[model samples]
Target: MMELAVVWSVLIAQTMLALAMAFALYRMARGPRAQDRILGLDTLYINAMLMLITFGIRTANTVYFETALIIAVIGFASSIALAKFLMRGEVIE
Candidate 1:
């Protein structure tokens, strides 16, 4: 019974994360401004990272956690670059 409950919970969480990702994609595509689009992209990355972590928990595996970490690092770097571009029109000096 407990195992069944765990499975159901994981499924529900994954479904929710997928829905969130879809909404983020829509926001990114339908944005009225660059800032809105950037925000959407950041939200998408965050949702993806969360989904990965959930997968790690469901599977009781370290591989998924490691992948999520990599995604987090990449997402952070990309968000910083996007913010720099927005503020200074360039990501690199």
Candidate 2:
């Protein structure tokens, strides 16, 4: 039953990832301020990247790991930029 356990684990991980994504989207849409929305976006991207890693494991595709890393870097950069803008009143200020 090892094969069945593996299948169930993958399925459960995927479902949890999907629910996380949906919650992030809801937060993004309902957030009361720009910073909150940006935070939600960052959360969504991070969760998506993690979901990609899970998919990679399930499908035995190493390429997805690289993609997830890239997405994580981009998400971090965007969050930094957004936070800076919030503090300075302008992106470049």
Candidate 3:
């Protein structure tokens, strides 16, 4: 049934997101360089956002979509700051 397929898809997506989050956390903790840590954090953020979207689909609610959008904007800002810091050795300098 279509309903069953949707459920399965949601389940699979959540599982993959969880795994990705775990891996990102590992990288963030173990990265040898600041840039690697920043990249891991970005990946973690994006994966969390996707996980929220999947939750929205499973619950048939729009709130998660808004949350995901906010997360995306915040993630973008964080990545930009990190990149700037890498380039200048200081975020504001």
Highest lDDT model number: 3
TM-score of 2: 0.91
Candidate whose TM-score is highest: 1
The RMSD of every model to the true structure, in order and in angstroms, is 0.9, 1.2, 1.2
- Please give, for residues 9-35, the per-residue lDDT of candidate 1 as tens digits: 999999999999999999999998989
Alpha-carbon lDDT, every model: 0.94, 0.91, 0.95
Instruction: Give the lDDT of residue 18 in candidate 3.
Output: 100
> Where in model 3 is the C-alpha error above 4 Å?
none
| lDDT at 53, model 3 | 95
lDDT (Cα, 0-100) at 77 in candidate 3: 96
lDDT at residue 31 of model 2 (Cα atoms): 91
